[model samples]
Target: MASTLYKWAGLLFLSSFPYIFTLRGDFVFDDTEAIVKNKDVSSESWTDCFYNDFWGTNIKSNLSHKSYRPFTILTFRLNYIMNNRQLSALSFKTTNLFCHILSTVLVWFTYKIVVNIQHLKKHKIDISYFGALLFAVHPIHIEAISGIVGRADLLCGTTFFLAFICYDKAINSQKHSSLFMVVTIILSAVSMLFKENGVTVLGFCLFYDMIHNIKNKKETQIYKFCNKINMKRITILMLSIVFLLYGRWAIMGGTKPEFKATDNPAAFADSFTKVVTHSYIHFLNSLLFVWPQWLCYDWSMGCVPLIQKFLDHRILCPLLMYLYGIFIIRAIFCKQNKKFTKRILLLSVALIILPFLPAANIFYPVGFVIAERVLYIPSAGYCLMISFGLNKIITRFNKYKLGLIAYIILLLIYGLRSWQRSYDWQSEYQLFVNGMLVCPLNAKIHYNIAKVSDARNKTDVALASYKEAIRLYPEYYQAMNNLANLLKNQKKYQDAEYYLRSALKYKQDYPAVWMNLGIVLASTKRLKESEQAYKIALQYRKNYPDCYYNIGNLYLEMKKSENALDNWLKAINFNRKHELAWTNMIALLDNTEQLDRALQLIPNALSELPNSPLINFAVGNIYGKMDRFEEAEKHFLKAISLFDRKVQAIHYANLGVLYHRWKRYDMAEIMYKNALKINPDFKTAIRNLISLQKYKNR
Candidate 1:
């Protein structure tokens, strides 16, 4: 009983591991859209926060049209309800830590329950213990456990383990409790709600039951009994659950479509090939988790492909891996093997590895195909296999003390690695920077670090990083476009144009890049070329609202009111929140003798960008155009207050005009003088003040 209690204590520690360490880290990777900017999760409505409505309608439409496990969403909603959704980093991190601990505990209990079901009692299954310990300290799991918003992985993993544990108990118990079955099914459903990946547990369950009965067919006659049980009912229940989970995806339509690469249909073929290639790639990820010498959050780990075979060539890593799998299978199934030990080892390996393959979606390669969060459930299986293997090895040694010492060293190493890995995930910048050390050849890593550097105002560093990313992967269209935009911001119009052209070479139909290129061309005084670029972007994606707004801005620069109005109206129609388009549309309407309509549009524009500096400046200019001097003065002052010195001069000059129009000569002179004070080379202020002096003399 004392030894049993010790085992229980160890299980509790593993379960509570997440709560033991807390780090308040900034958002990283997908957390930005999933948590920070997610309107539904951040909203007060319980229904909106918890349900999939936000996913299908808002995020899926614009960004990713894929189903995520909904259990995570519910966790976010719970956090919101518990804390009023207002959280500092510490509070948010604490919630993640709590969930992680809960999942860890669930993992420990799930293993204990499974072993108990087998009734192969060995007090010194230290191999299993260390496997569980290794799982607790696996560096790769930090991304899922340490990050605050990764509560989704924790909640989903926890529920998945719970459901598995209950299912094992229900299947193995002599009395076969219906309550356990009901609870397991309910928990599985909850896991599905948290994340799409959680549905994978059911696959494991089906496979485990089938395998367990097969192995026990003669010895326990379990096969005959299980066959008598309504296997069809179980299969139907499982099918119903799967359909209920993913049926909406089929009804709603397929996943979000990606733009064809280089306008080539052949790229589709390449993408399909990438799916098979990715299986080999994904297999490498599991190998790392097993050995875990170097771990990275970014999935774009580099390995050169073999060129000899078009279809049947096995890459070295995957080839060796396949051989190892074959060896393991043969060892488990050989006629000379001990039946119980073989069953245990095979089951452990299968549980750890099989369920993960579906998520890898090996037939379709995606960007960052391997992620740590994907391993949350798989880790349990890995730990059990490792623990059982260690025990087998220790039995050969005979000297228990030496074997125990070896186990301790292994656990310590894993613990230390895990602790170090946790620090890397403390924030986005740190995670990207550290991940780069392990995955330096990954273009996405370099690109991610460049985004952070840009945010930190390290423009030169950002430029170099972007350049390096493009150098490594010339087909990296997003990096090329971003580098061009960065150059455009620095007034390197010629260089910007070159980079933009390079982006177009690979992704010719990218609407955003085309819009950006157009904006840069117009700035460089290439009006015809700018117009051509804008027209091309609109041709590709007719509903692209930003492109329409950008083209409208170009027309406005050329003083083409009719052309500007047409584009701005199109922009507003595409996105109701296109505030700049609305503002520009109102200005164009006022010029076209539609004062009432223009006036009516002001509130709508104000509603979107309320108190925004640029919006206030635009509003002030509109008031000036309408000859509402007092209103113009009010808005101009507001704009000036929001502006930094460089932009404030424009507001001051506009205010001087408002004063002059109102016949406030002294005020006009003062305002003009103030504008000149702010900017020494204030051309408009200088001319306005001279005119005011002449007026006074007359």
Candidate 2:
């Protein structure tokens, strides 16, 4: 009992030790779309978490991810709820780490089940310990552990193992077999709910059942497989597969159209060429299991060289295919009655190949060439191969400590590498910096690095990164739009406008490019052209408050008072905290002598924006107009006291107007002089001071 307990504790500790630094990690990659801005996790309606895709409850166009992984999203929602309805990075990240830990424990149990099979009892090397340990610390899984969005893979793997373990017990059970069967069914659904790849559990169950029957019957060939198939078990597994596929088709509208050339990779290939290239790419991804180094977050097109020619560096493709067939044949035959033959090989192959099917992009492209997170499920199989391979050596030569030394060194290397790589998830900047070094041709990594640089106000560095991204992938319109924004900030309006137009030329479907073009055109004082661009932006993106706000400003400048008021109202409706719209509405009301209505709206604006300096200052101006000097002073002083309010000479001059109306000529004169001191050429301060001098003289 104590030994079993110690093993469990030891496995959990080994799994968790390398990932301890993840508690300090920041959200990166798809973390922004999935957790940061996802309203489904933030809102109260839990049904929104299920019915809609990851993008949102109301997906207009499928430009963004529309994956229906409700259970995975539910976990993130639960984390947000626990963190007081705020998206706490630590809380979200800890939940991801928790799943990794749970999967580690499950891996130990699953490997134990593999070893304890009736045909494989003699090879008692405790692969359960080392298999789980290797899987726990594999550096390739850093993408899954460090990034919050990678939880889908973790959840899918956990439930897949749990289903297998439950099924194993069910078959061996006399009492309550039906209950276990029902639980396994429920787990099958739960696994698929976390990720579309969860359908692979069906393959796992079918293979396990087949291999079990084959071991008892002593059969050896793929064609002569499952000669005595249990109709009941096969029927049940088939029904599970059918149900998952039907549910997926019903929920998500079959396959989506690729939004970019890179999205449809097969289009870049000519029929059989793509299949062979894709096969070679798959081989490379699996090879990482043996020697997991130069691990990348993305391996989009340019990042990895494709196998266009038949005689390329990936020449081992034909050999790998041959060896794969041989492994299955050898496993089925069990010619040597080796413990690793029948069950282990079957289980390992199922683990590697089943989860890989959905993401293989053989039927259709999955929008990217490669992503490491997709390998999380398959890595379990790799770990099994490694654990037993090490076990065979330990059994062969106990006297020579060569295998033991290799095992120790392997563990140290994997463990230390995982620990060091966990910090790459500390921030997007770190991940991009590290990833670019590993994959310099990955356009997405360069683009992300540019965004981080721009956020930090390192414009020169950001410009270089953005240019580098475009150099790598010329059709990156998103990077072009951002590059234009940087040029706009530098007041190179013509250059900015040129890039914005070029962005539209590449991808006219993007609404943000139109909006940016509107802004850049307006900066050049082309009001008609700017208005046309804004209208186009609205046509593409209906809920754009910024576009509405800018349009309102343009209308006001064009003397279209009613149009300005209507647009500002729309902007405020969309985003109540939009200070520009609220301030403009108050000014329009004040100009039209609708002071009472303007006064009522001030409280509403304040409720949304409690610290809005413009709102407070405008309230002061209104109260002073109403001859309420005390209330006027209170609000005006509040606005002035805020250091972030960007106080100017006009603010002090406005204060002078307030004091001048209150007939405090002495105080008013001081205020006017202070305004003039800040802006020596201010006509308003000069006129106010001269008028106050006459009152003081009296």
Candidate 3:
């Protein structure tokens, strides 16, 4: 008992040691949309997860990605709640590491069951221990472990192994068969709810039962198969599967997810190209298990070119993979081999092939070309096969020391690689830059690079990366939209307009692009065109507060103060904490001399945005306009203290004006000089300082 406990402790240490560096890593890639920006997982009601997609959009909405993993989102919400409703990447990643350790232990137990079923004699090298150890430290699992959003795969794998174990117990046990079957059904359902591909575990359970029956009875006749199996339990399992399928379909509103050609280009290609390319992808996925050296965050947008011709050299890879598969199948069913060997080979192949079929792009199209996280479960099969082969080399060739050395070396190399990969996930910039190195031609990688660069205010680097992304994939509407936003910021309205229109040519229903186009049109003084663009954007996404805020600005330019106020009110109704909308409304009211109404709105705005420096600044300006000097001074100081990074020069200049109006000449001069220190060329501060000096001289 003590030895077994030590073995599991060792497995836990091996699984978590390589990933300790990732505890400090920030949320990168899909973690932004799925965790940080996802209201379903952050501030929304817990039950909302069941009604929304993984990214927080309603599952029935046309814009939904239809990834209904509520169970996984619930885990994210729990993490958020545990961290006091703040985004703690450390807490989230630590939970992911713990779940991964749980999965590693589950793999160990499942492999032990499979080995015991084969009735193999105990040997010096424990296949279950080594197989699970290999799985724990495999470098290919880094993507699933380091990325916070990859908890879906980790949770699904845990429940998948648990479900399979329950099914095995149900079939073999005499006294507790009914209880075990009930547990199996619940686990299977829980597994599928965690991830879409987890339903394949039921298929694995059925395959295992069939193989177990065949091995025991030595049955060769196909007609006797159904009689040998427990029909009542099989019927219940099939019914449960049918019900689960119905539930999944209903949750998606019976509408398939929409994907563009860039997401999975092969799915939209001609039949020959699709077939040839998908097979090549299968070959590539297999290679990742054998040699997981080339890893990237994304594999789309021409990362693997479509095989258009029969003569294409990549086509040879699929042919070789198929031949190898055939060889394995023959070995599994060969009468010349011992029964134990046949059983081991058969179960290993089932483990490899069954769980992977959902991601094979056979029944339906997926949104990615290749995802490393999907290999987390299938790697168990690969580990088992390799561990068995190593045992064979030691026993058959009598090279025990050499075989053990090779096993240790393999673990060391993979563990070091996993440790190195964790650093790439430290920030979005590092992660996307590493992805670019692995897949330079992949336009999605370039687009991500541009996004991270734009966030850091590196405009030149951002522009170059965006152009490269657009050059690589001309129909990349997302890249075009983002590049147009950067150009708009640089005041190149004409260039921005061109890219926004070009993006609309490809994706007309994109509300974000429409909103950005409206902003560009507004900058160029095309008020009517801008209003039309804003309306179009609202038609697609009715709850978009940013669109309403922009439309309010447009109405202000058109001299429609009432209309501007109404739009700003709508913006606040949709998003109560929209600081820009609240501030703009206060400014408009002050301009129109509606000081009393603006003051009345301040309490509500402060309640929603208690620490918003912009709202506080607006409050100070309103108080100053109303001649409440003491209140104005208090609000201004609070605003300056609450400034996120740096207080703007205009804030200080406005406070200087307040001091000047209150007849505090010395304090007014200090405020003006502070503003000038922050921005030497600030015109408002220079003019204010000149006027204050004249007053002091008088």
Q: Best candidate, TM-score-wise?
A: 3
Clashing residue pairs found in predicted model 2: none
Q: What is the lDDT of candidate 2?
A: 0.81
- Rate residue 484 of model 1 by lDDT: 90
Looking at candidate 2, the ten consecutive residues that score lowest on lDDT are 220-229
lDDT of each: 0.71, 0.81, 0.90
- Please state the error at residue 303 of candidate 2 in Å: 2.0
What is candidate 1's lDDT per residue for 349-442, written digit by digit as tens? Answer: 7676655764664444343445677777777787787777667777766767777787778777767677767777777788888877876777
Better of 1 and 3 by TM-score: 3
Which 10-residue span in candidate 3 carries the lowest summed lDDT?
219-228
- lDDT by residue (298-318, candidate 3, tens digit) is 999889999998889889999
- For model 2, the superposed segments whose C-alpha errors exceed 4 Å read 57-66, 119-124, 218-229, 254-259, 264-268, 315-334, 337-340, 588-597, 640-698
TM-score of each: 0.79, 0.89, 0.94
lDDT per residue as tens, model 2, 248-299: 7766666463445454354477766677777777777877777777777777
Error of 2 at 233 (Å): 2.0
